[model samples]
Target: MLGVPKDEKPTWISRLAAQPAVHRAIRTFRLQELTSAALKVRPIKRRLPKSGIEYRVRYLESFLMADEIFQRKIYREAFEGLDVRSFVDLGSNVGYFPLFAVELTGRRDLVGIAVDGNRSMTDETRWHVDHNHLANVKPLWGIVGYPSDVKEATFYLNPSNVSCSAQPVLNPDVPSKGRIKEVTVPTVDVASAWMQHAGDVRVDVLKIDVEGFEREVLRTCGALLDKTSSVVVEWHKWIASQDEVEALLRDRGFVRFRTISEDPYCGVAVYRPRAS
Candidate 1:
């Protein structure tokens, strides 16, 4: 897929010109004043309180934004009744989901392998893991896909935003403003990588949120699905159709599982293969 162009200044200007009237109005507002007001409403330096776990949780609520809440909800539902020994967190942007999983499972025996195509995100994840003294998790930097050995692809680096995918996807309706950098990285087959590194280990839960590349990763990891007890994926609308993903999983013996959220844009689906 074509990465964002090296000379993205034109694209950035075009994006600004295409913004909706409401967004344009917001941009015209006193930027610093708006930022100050937001900070006053929710300060960034607020720390988790030192108290009982319940009190700490209450304090933590001040820190969690919308995405964190969504991640927590899915983590709870995915591992509710099962014993999760190992978790494979693909596209683990800041390791928040993996950390949340560790806290939810409450198991020191837990092993987490967090992978992302962005090196900076992986570094941040590593820092967060070490800062929290999480000994069981390992963060890897790479893209996962069907062609494991493929070495070169245009990678789009969206400033400090690591969750943004390197894959080329254009939405005529949505406008974006920012510079993107070109990067080259190694891509691996999910199944082969897991087998090589996590061979003897059984994966209890696998969570994937690779922007638009989820289907490709699944295709590459077909051999490892049998050992996976459950899979949770945030399907991308631009890459593969829902019916296609469902059929692919069905052929592999998995059944569609629902999530609590109704937002189809970021639908979270769980799958468990039928027992023989």
Candidate 2:
């Protein structure tokens, strides 16, 4: 309840539990089971036969993300026939997206830059890249969506590792078991950093999921959008609406062609240059 917004309405389940002592007891029992499950979670080693890659995921969220990327095929179109020689993930958690790119493209030579604001998560990403022998994938510990002049920024690390975000006020509601932690991380400007990492090659696929700081990310994207071929962004409407995000991309000559998934809290959309 700490992170719940003041104006937010109670969820149906919350309302249901408030009706009777029996309902409240049921809710309490369910919550206890959920907490027990969370406590028992341990590192899991999973191998994707198609990709021929073994993932070392520590958290339940990481496994769920694996399901999203590998099973759901949310970004399938982004890699279908794009000849993705290079890609960048703005909020790479444990490097699943880039791994999926490698799997989807079947290109071991593919170059990827995975960036994360949380040091622990970034380290996990690096472990995945190293252990899996993804020679071309580089894991960076930094924050994106800020001006190049800005060297470092404050980042909030949520208990759900994948929910780590740059915007302080955009923190997601967490279980009462854990509190949000703040840390300063180095900032990256995609334009300059991309060139430095993978040379001047146009970005084959650009995946952005910086929690709710997407507007800032797009603002600093500058001319880099022109050099990008495909963009798959997960937009948080609570901080910046889908329309606002799409408008920013439209201004840079992009058109939203697909809405992979959507909900009240967030949505994932794919974009491509209008001329293409």
Candidate 3:
């Protein structure tokens, strides 16, 4: 309820619950459990305007649904004409960003590698790719950070949200932390993952949404930095400060940067390599 929008309309179940006839019919049919189960899913399929591309996603289970719905125009503006031939989505829950890239660029042949630490999420992403007959989406299941196999490394799984992370503290002030479970997942360095997944291919767009562990993910990408033209990162003040993130990118030669969101703590930033 906290993250849900103010003007969000009632779900179908809420509407049905309001009607006595609907309840009576369900009780008569003895399908209350089935009906209840079906009503819980929110927006199973999303169709991009003018692209004729439809993606089936678990919208309610992840935070990405809001982005896919409300932030459609923003993504179009940020990546529409970026010439993204090879794209990598870190923390790709159900693979919406990759689909956006393919649809926006109008290049179905573009290479997309979706990386997520959660096995179920990776499986779901693979299913989406297979369901759409997409040969370009490479879904990889592994923790995204440098110095793999650390002793204390653990991923905190959010019960309601699919976008879980290694860092547990979302915000002390924010009551809804969303973390429900913890699991030890195999880790992969960002630089190695880029080379192994995208190899020899210049990644035109690199999108990372690794919850709070962004610094670790960005620290080891020096090898992949030159190949990447546009970098989009969701920075969280709860995990790492914004100044550290900006300075890291600037030191790597991405001098041109712009803030996408007004919230410094929960902000999105776009960076491009400095002109030589």
Considering TM-score, which of the candidate structures 1 and 2 is the better prediction for this target? Answer: 2
* Residue ranges of candidate 1 with Cα displaced over 4 Å: 1-72, 160-163, 170-174, 262-264
Higher-lDDT candidate among 1 and 2? Answer: 2
Tens digits of per-residue lDDT for model 3, 172-206: 44334233688887776666666776678888878
TM-scores, all models, native as reference: 0.73, 0.83, 0.77
Poorest 10 consecutive residues by lDDT, candidate 2: 1-10
| Cα lDDT for residue 197, candidate 2 | 82
lDDT of 2 by residue, 117-147 (tens): 9997788889888988889888889998887
* Model 3 CA lDDT for position 19: 51
Model 1 TM-score relative to the real fold: 0.73
Reference-based lDDT, residue 276, model 2: 78
Given candidate 1, what's the lDDT at residue 30? 42
Model 3 vs truth, CA RMSD? 7.3
| Superior candidate under lDDT, 1 versus 3 | 3
Compute the lDDT for candidate 2.
Answer: 0.74
